[model samples]
Target: MTTTRTADPTAEPGAPSTTTQASLYQQLRAHLAVLRLYDAAEHLPAVLDAAIAEGLSMTAALERLLAVEVDATEARRLAGRLRFACLPTPATLAEFDYDAAPGVDRALIDELATCRYLESATNILLIGPPGTGKTHLAIGLVRSAAEAGYRTYFTTAADLAARCHRAAIEGRWATTMRFYAGPTLLAIDELGYLALPAEAAAAIFQVVSQRYLKTSIVLTSNRGVGAWGEILGDTTVAAAMLDRLLHRSVVLNLDGDSYRLRAHQARNETLRKTTTGTRKPLS
Candidate 1:
């Protein structure tokens, strides 16, 4: 025995045709499916009507109904430029000894969530051996700061030098410096991995010197502090650059076996993927 219902004169245009209980269930299912809730949300009247007819808990029904809606709103909250979303959570978990430093306290990781130093224009330096989470920490902190309403820009020391060289040739060196220096926190990774030319060294020094007390920066490098002079290839310029950078900086020294080296030896390593691209294990 089926009952038919007439359409209301005030129904909205393009509204689903719901002339029967079955039709109403079908419309609801279609609406919910548009939001992608497909676990038994088929166009079946008995499924929905039975719940309502049996006086099931409305609270429970509404909870199930709005699951997708809550997830969508949360996804939008994490909307910031990310360098590498593929960074495994294991890197940030407590298993990593994030607190093994003096000035570079892991305690700051919690404090930095509020972006105080970034707001105050202080720089952070993560000095460590290769594959000891220098890049990971820098990227993580940049993501944290960016999510807290600060703009973040990431580049390697090599690419930065290359771009600066290009800008110099094009007579826009200052423009390029401002481009990278504009971010609330600029994450410059691998500062000493590749050798840099003299002019690139000076331009980089100029940028660092200018940002002193004016903006925040985060750098990760595999080279030791003494070797930086060699990497820059100009002892005088390197000294001056360090003067400005180390004035009020939090310096982190990471000392350990290369996590990368350990993984390669065991053959248990997985290639880490980044937004720019994927790289195989570096020897």
Candidate 2:
């Protein structure tokens, strides 16, 4: 039988040294050419160049590609946390308890995965007193949306407002707004925690207004519909904001004992070790 050189596994091929070039792409390309990986290296150049342009070293990019290539078995496991488009999805929905929202309708859970609405770019309002997993469920929903290969962006209302304010001061308002507005689904969490300045409120409202019927957003707030006017500080602005947000929106009113308080009690009980195995001092 004749042995073929291309199929030979023990070939001592020439290897390129990396002492000359300032970049990883040049070095890898040279090495690949020396090893006669011209066809394989064709794809590597573009991927490597893109990674380098994004400020990653050639070696680092190759390492990342190798990890991805070798972890083929983890393709399914990576689905939830990996393929997110606009929002980040959690690793699993199993950790969240839907039973906590006492008066909440079960229709909301069904709506969580409803991509048609999100693709149409509607709003999802998650309102609650405090805790009650409003943020958790919002985040979980956003995560699920992201895992399904939708682009997602997440921020607190305060953070988004502050960022917009800073951008205006820095004269980067247009650029910042363009970037923030481009996401397919933007999640604004913790809405009622801080009072936004008039300008900040206006900026945030502009974002909400611009997003109306154009993009989806997951809003988590601790305000009742009645109290939102006070939080926004301008009735007309608030009214307009409400008109934009509430239309085509799925509102989830989550109310119950504060999860923070329950967590505190649980932690205290766990630490209470005594001689009688009760609430006595450990000493």
Candidate 3:
């Protein structure tokens, strides 16, 4: 007697059986969805192809997939932080014109860029005349801090003072103060641009007191320390705030003509020489 074999019921006539393969794909998608690995799930096929083509081990393939997901997640997080920071512009140390601002200490600025001062809650005070790149330096350092994974904030002294005053009136001063102090690095620019009233002066002092020794600060001012009392309109408050800030601060006084003015003059001279083949006499 001859025995005859029967075909599998799950197999098709001209196609390989794919029940196990389909089941695995479904299970993978479900797990990835549950774990919120959308990016990895979307790129799974391509990455798998690459891995297989490269003869990667199972462990190596997993690492490659996870690395892509991790990188995407970190990029999104950094973008969110930068948006929340509200930096005037995206400034970096590389874009800074070190040659134009000779007064600034390149070595010190570079060291600060490493974000070591933040570990110790040290303050940085950029004192300079108008257009001497104080604001640029402050923004650069704050950007650096943010890139280094530190929470950072940027606000002008006038704006901060106004916010604090409003919060006080609304009985939300504590909450607002906490928000300002929460950042790892808070950069307050144009400190002496507008003279503060007594209430604003007090508000400024409260913020400084709250964050003193707790977080780092990068302050840019066009006024000297002695003039702060008059600018803030409260001698005692100014003294106290300065005492706290200056105690552990790195002070840099930028002494030079305004960078903006110099740039403007250079442009004008170029234009004059171009228009009429003669140099314009300086006043």
Question: How well does candidate 2 match the true structure, expressed as C-alpha RMSD?
Answer: 10.0
lDDT of 1 by residue, 1-283 (tens): 9998687777543244556844775577787778675543542333345456667586765664465456554445555344332222323323345543333466766776567887678888888878777877777777777566667777888877888888999999778878876777787888998877777787788778767888888888888767778989988888888888888787878777676776686564333334226655679
lDDT: worst 10-residue window of model 3: 10-19
- Taken over the whole model, the C-alpha lDDT of each candidate is 0.70, 0.72, 0.87
* Candidate 2 residue-wise lDDT, 1-283, digit = tens: 9965342354223222233533554677688779765554655645555575787885877775555444543454446334433334453344576665567666657666666678667788888878688777777766666656666778888888889989999999889888778867888988888888778668878898778888988888898877877888877888888889988888878888887888888888767643247655659
Pairs clashing within candidate 3 = none
- What candidate 3 gets wrong by more than 4 Å, as runs, is 1-19, 277-283
Better of 2 and 3 by TM-score: 3
Candidate 1 clash figure, as a count:
0
Ranking according to lDDT, highest score first: 3, 2, 1
**Predictions ranked by TM-score, top down?**
3, 2, 1
Structural similarity to truth (TM-score) of each candidate: 0.64, 0.67, 0.89
Query: What value does the lDDT take at residue 200 in candidate 2?
Result: 66
Candidate 3, residues 196-223: lDDT per residue as tens digits? 6568888888888999998999999999
Better of 1 and 2 by lDDT: 2
- Candidate 1 lDDT score relative to the true structure: 0.70
Candidate 2 CA-lDDT value: 0.72
